[model samples]
Target: MMRYLIALMCFFTLQNVYADMTLTIMDQDNKPVSDAVILLSKESVSTPDAVAIMDQIDESFVPRVLAIQKGQYVNFPNSDDIRHHVYSFSKPKAFEIKLYKGSEIPPIAFDKPGLVVLGCNIHDDMIGYIIVADNSYVIKTDKDGKASLPVKQGDIVTLWSERFIEGVNTTKEINITNDTEQTLSLELLPPIEIMDHSMGYGFGKKQW
Candidate 1:
């Protein structure tokens, strides 16, 4: 009788976790990875209440990276008190915001799902990245590499990061199960180091 009650409690606990699942993302070095985005296989068109903002400050993109759902709008606000010419030639979304300052720039809507590399035509040192997915997923890892993703059986969780190792798979797809452990430590390669050439001045510089 005692054994039967314990088994029943376990079944109930699993059912309760359908909406309270959490995951911890880590790199191959067992260190917490930041700016990692978690997405679901299913797609949703519902937009979140708040709009996304990508600010330009101190000659650099404040967040460096951003992730948003498709059909969402992103505002590029210049807070550096200087002019900026932001543009992206990425296949998903190709557009440019001519030289401007302050928050006068209009918000650009992203309708496709892919990576958008941001660059400043005037500042060779400035760069930023934006990833647009299909849904309003809220599972991006924080500074401590922790995020809560309400998951269900057979759900596929996709992960992506800019710092993922080179020549290796940068994105990951995980299968969900009710019997999954409480913590999941993923193995992603460290970022590839590039030569510091952002400050270089002159023509013929690398263009995004």
Candidate 2:
């Protein structure tokens, strides 16, 4: 039992020593864009514990954009008093949550990697986006368009956003080290028609 205890402690200590890295992303005209997904992976990483919540409040999705590892689940809860019939038609994974007053059922699992556009059959104006990534090490950029994570050294990381087509913008890779800090600048296309209706909420944009 003493040997087992020592090994367990060592395991936790190593887990806490994952390499620290910070990624900053920018768009054309040098503006910060939030909700961009950053994934660090040399190979596919599976995270069974990762789950995202795309809540509904005041007739709009609380989090308009989401990032999740493929095979992860997403729970859509209604905080408002009205019922919601949430559904998605995006091809990566498609399903519908029948009209419900609250999150009374289990979450819907996204088993494939693709963009899932969420909409409500009952509410025409409600829209949400669930970006299912192919790896487990995923983090979303904050209002400053930055994300900080402890990644393993040598992991290959990539940045992605909805503003660009998935093929060209997401293919570039960066290798991480023990103390790698980088500012990845990306120029995006001008705000399109869809951006007008998107749920735009910036999270913690501080002057640097």
Candidate 3:
């Protein structure tokens, strides 16, 4: 009898998660914008425990992006033979890890929900991002500029991007009961100036 009751509860929980939303984002010139982070907040936020990894490979932050729920942990592993220091100045989660090699350092826990801009002080060109979301409904747009997520109706919707200008509409409210699709226009700051392409990624023959 106890097993029967547990099975029924699980069924109802799964049924309530059918609220899915498909999102599309366009930049100032109406070009599909990738790497945009989507945040969904509910009156009660609950996410299964998760651990994310940001790998240091080829002198660059591989994947270049990551999303994790608030209070979760993130592992930054150096895949290259040389050492790399990872730090972020973003207000959401400002932290710095000393120069190190491999995953010997304990995984960092992102307690606050916010964006973390990662960089290697030694390797200026190596950059990455970590979006620590308060809610579990967090996902970044794909290279093709499309993504779908399961979000309950009446949840608050917020959008964030590194390219957003000082003054811009960065948040929006979303209501979805059934599967829905949306297209949005976003204003962004001017593109950043191109930087050097030959910067050492810590993997070259420099023999540090």
Candidate 4:
């Protein structure tokens, strides 16, 4: 009977070490920031096998910003009736899919960790971003700027947003613990530019 109690205690201890945490991000004005990426540092992380999609519709990428684990595949499907050219010159990965309509293009695998700025040769105004991460514990904030994930105590988590100033420190490291607040409010640096979402545009500027 004593051994059974000890085993149960060990199970509870493990649960405490890996607890579910909720993180909230805000801008300098205390407004909930959406589309912010949340990344966790984990030792046993591995590349995901699922293929993500970045579709183009109405001369614009549906989800202007996409977050993916390193070595994951991304399919660029042109939903618009007109042909579009997709390309990126970022260092992490550089490739281009020539003028095409629909999903005829093959999936591109992102093998490195960094931001891949996407653009089109034909449409000068269209822009998109693919943020490749090395760790599997990645989460993007919802419209309310909140995300929940299972995090271990002492684990460091980083946050990224395109709205941040180009040359500023955009990462936030938090030591997770049982006493840590579930809802953390952080004021980020001023944004380089803000897009009019109501007009169907997303975050970030045309520059790399």
Candidate 5:
């Protein structure tokens, strides 16, 4: 009986030792971005399942932007008075939700990893993003543009942005076992010249 009790204690201790790691992300300006998504993955672990995206009212996609595991389903629900034609040319899942007034079509499955840009055929100003990730440790950054990720020592962490320029960026490799807290500061280049209604949608100009 005593040996069994010892074994049980040992099991619990091992479980506690394998706790997840945490990652904190912030922009160059040290401001918290509420909707930034973070993803973590390792070759050894199997990829997580997929999720869904819903299309709601006001001629806008619900959640505005979403990050999900690869193979997840994205549901388009029309909650508006008019019809919307939703489509994406992303290599992962290139499909379209033809003109529909309500929730008539089933959810779309994204089976690969890539950025899926969503748009409405009727509304030229409507835009959204579907980021399909293979990692299980994914999270959307809070209002402070910060994201805490559960990770482990020696794990490879990566950060991505749609507007990330080719060069003029920095990434720091952190050793989790060496320090309890790690802070990274990156300087982003100025925004490129482009014409769009991104300002109307409440997205400010890309300022580093």
Candidate 6:
């Protein structure tokens, strides 16, 4: 009889420990952005370990946007027939993945918190972003631009996206004391045009 009572108490305790919060991100036109990235952090929460980024065929970064905690490892694997040179010039960690063909090399560790822009020297069209955050409760938006955050009551959650300009968009803030649903709408300006310089590969010269 005592064992049965104890088991019931433990189950209820675990249930109360976990909470859920829903987040919705929308553009100015009220359309969901399927490719948005979501990040969550708390002041007292400990930073979690980092993750890796794998490079697959066609010289493209799988999961174009990735999120990791500070001081984590980002593995860059070249699963293609040709060689690849992966390098990042962001403020967090600047390093290069030399020309390689297989997964024999170790992963790169990013210890700082910043945005790491990745590009392949061999493939000019390949581009990726690595966002190293300081907390563990983070997730990427789904096709409907919706994400559920597992957070406790009174935790501050911040949202970030490359599409929204810093000064123009308003970031939605909320407290997760109960199951709540919130929508965020951002008005983004036109993206800055970058000069293309990929014509040197002998594919036919074109003006930038």
Best by lDDT: 4
TM-score between model 2 and native: 0.67
C-alpha displacement of 28 in model 1, angstroms?
2.7
Q: For each candidate, what TM-score against the reference?
A: 0.74, 0.67, 0.70, 0.79, 0.67, 0.70
lDDT of each: 0.73, 0.72, 0.72, 0.75, 0.61, 0.67
Superposition TM-score, candidate 5 onto the true structure: 0.67
Better of 4 and 6 by lDDT: 4
Of 3 and 4, the candidate ranking higher by TM-score = 4
Instruction: Give the range where candidate 2 is weakest over 10 consecutive residues by summed lDDT.
Output: 199-208
The count of backbone overlaps in candidate 6 is 2
The superposed Cα distance between candidate 5 and the true structure at residue 190, in angstroms, equals 8.9
Residue 117 lDDT in candidate 1: 86
User: Can you list the residue pairs that collide in candidate 3?
Assistant: 59-201
lDDT of 2: 0.72
Candidate 4 lDDT over residue span 1-208, tens digit each: 9999999999998877665767777777888878788787664467878888887866887577799989999999886778899999889999999999877688999999878889999999898888788866788888788888677656678777877665322555766653334556665666434344444422221212
Give the C-alpha lDDT of model 5: 0.61
Clashing pairs in 1: none
Q: Judged by lDDT relative to the true structure, which candidate is superior, 3 or 4?
A: 4
Least well predicted 10-residue stretch by lDDT in candidate 4: 199-208
Tens digits of per-residue lDDT for model 1 on 1-208?
9999999999998776566566677777778777777887564547655668887766777567788878889988876667899999998899999999877677889988878889999999888888888765645787777777777666778877776654222577877664343445665666433333345321223323
Candidate 6 error regions (>4 Å): 1-18, 43-51, 151-155, 166-179, 189-208
lDDT of 1: 0.73
Candidate 4 residue spans exceeding 4 A from truth: 167-170, 177-181, 188-208
Give the TM-score comparing model 4 with the true structure, all chains together.
0.79
